[model samples]
Target: MSTPQPPTHQQAAPAPNWQAAPGTSYVSPIPITRTHLGHALASEWTKIKSVRSTMWTLGVFLLLVVGVGLLVAVNTTTEDYTEVPYTIPAFFGLILGQICLITLGVLVVSSEYGTGMIRTTFTASPQRYRVLTAKLIIFFVVAFAVSAFAIGLVGLFTSSLHDGESGTPWGRSVLMGALYVSLLGVLALAVGSMLRHSAGAITTMLGVVLVPAILPAFLMLSDSMRTIGEKMMEYNAPNALARIFELDTDSGTGGSQLALLAGVTAAAIAGAYALLEKRDV
Candidate 1:
């Protein structure tokens, strides 16, 4: 009668488990931890190693580097101490094997886009930039370590095989060259991220690495052009690596090429990061 007050039939909300997180207050049976870069790293590592492309590419690369390195060491019977460093043989294998590294680099990012897995990657980690950073870091570390190992093994073999011809700081030489190659791989990853297509990214990177070297060979028509060609030949990634290994005919360039490559790669990666933010999956 007092306006027929509705029955005070009320039920209290269930108490939340203090141990669980906000979103999982009722869903989770156990506690959950916030994700960090370490979690991203683990995810990236799992993705990288689980792919067949990684295994095949790295396997072929190892075969080329070690086999050719050992063969070169076994065949060099004379020591031209004044003309060559014994560690130079490693560069030959690296030159031929680098395509594999570039391929792996492109595949690392572009393959996700190619297969439409990038959506899941982004969905899992909404911070697109963080995912990219993780991929770049994982790719760079794997590349540098593998390249250093191959070069070091070859350098030691060459050092023992042609001890008299070896120059001082062979380890430094090996490491520098490995660093250059790894940088190139990172550049490839940037290209992959920007292009977002496996074949396209791989092809573009191949051109980046190979075209400057190849173009120089065709531009021998005039002195001015030939000079340009010579500069390109001297400054390309492969040539920079050769110089790092002390294989270049002239050491005039020092490490300026590597520094240049690094700068260019940084710019490319920055651009890629911006593009990732602007573009839709």
Candidate 2:
């Protein structure tokens, strides 16, 4: 038999098959999009309001600002410009409230990291820019609102204390203060997002913002130190923030410096988002 012609060899393979398991069905993943910003904003707003710190900080911020204004108005030896010269009280109280805003900003980004919920956040909003943008929008809105309350309370209280004195230009002051507070919160959020370490971000912000202002005052050399202080004043945190006041305190030292700081801060926030987008959360 022709050696039984060598049989042509062919591979045997498992049959193609498909079946659904009992009580099981295919589920598709939800598509993420920019429109998801609304959901993100709602979620963030819920998270912010649910926190105890938010309540405490708002209360304390209002109390300190209003209390200090009352003190300054009541004790003023001369009602120089009426309005009880609440600048000292308002300014210092604002500085204190800023620390709280920093903490709030940190929580905006870090709380998710702390709880391992950032993964979910990223999942729900895979387009990282949307998530960050949503966060910033929410922060700006919330910060502006809270700052208004604090500033308003101070103005109201100060106005009450000054019976014979004219009202301060608080309407403008409050508006400007609100803007400053919003910017400060944004700065904190950007730094916190970039660093991802609560302690490190907070410490760095405080050190950079507060320590430099103090250093200028301590130097022994008067003229040179004054020059250094003046130059450094151009970089000081308060000046950058003081822009909201709108009162022309000094040209080079206050608004100009803060305007520069705001510009730099906006750039930093953008850079931070870029890094956050490129890195693993």
Candidate 3:
């Protein structure tokens, strides 16, 4: 009979309060801090160091720059350098080595796009410009440092081998040469950022670096184009590098070359920033 009478529904006890106690706040175990450029720089440094391409490209670069430079020095007599700076030998190697830097620069940005890692990168760092800036800074520093070291090493070797051959401005030439090559890498990075394709960006940069130099030769064949060809020879990357090392004395100062390249690089970087901001990951 008691079963027949449905048990009265007991009032459900009030759910226990799950909110934080009054005047108390839950603290996350993870530290919360606003990220800045330093964090971005660290991330970029880690990335640049960790990649296999970075190692391979830079290794080849050092090998070409130092190896060829030393080889050239070993083959030459002191008289060979009397008319040119001891550091001029480094120029021969750097002509080939610059390609490595350019390739590395393109890979710095475009590889991420090819591998779909750029999405993750953009997700983690929503401030795209900061990420680009970090890449630029890291790449430039590494490229410049390695370039300077290789060129400097070669210069030291040549100077020791041919001491007192001439009172060349080796120090200034080394600095300017390194700056020129590093700026080329920076420009490649800007192109990479804009193109977002490793092969295409790399190819485009190769054209940028090589085409002008080569086109001038063809243009020189034409009488009317000879002036334009001469202009190209003056401003092209190889000639600029040559001038920076004081190898081309007939031309004007290398300062103009640096300024021109700097302006072009600045413009490309501006374009890269604009596209990065406007485009989707």
- lDDT: which candidate is best? 3
Ranking by TM-score: 3, 1, 2
Clashing residue pairs in all predictions, respectively, total 0, 1, 0
Candidate 1, superposed: residue stretches over 4 Å from native:
1-32, 81-84, 162-165
By summed lDDT, which 10 consecutive residues of candidate 1 come out lowest? 161-170
Candidate 1 local Cα displacement, residue 157, angstroms: 1.7
Q: State every prediction's TM-score relative to the real structure.
A: 0.87, 0.77, 0.88
| Evaluation by TM-score, superior candidate among 1 and 3 | 3
Whole-structure CA lDDT of model 1: 0.84
Alpha-carbon lDDT of model 2: 0.70
lDDT of each: 0.84, 0.70, 0.91
How many steric clashes does model 1 contain? Answer: 0
Put down candidate 3 lDDT per residue, 51-142, tens digits, no spaces: 99999999999999999999988888887776678888899999999999999999999999999999998888899999999999999999
In model 1, state the lDDT of residue 120: 96
lDDT of 2 by residue, 1-281 (tens): 45677788999987545444446684334332345668878877887788887777667766666666566556653354443234434765786777777777877887777778889988877878878887888887988898877777766665565553554555666766767767777888898888888888888778867886787776535875787776666566676545445334555324555476678679878888888878897
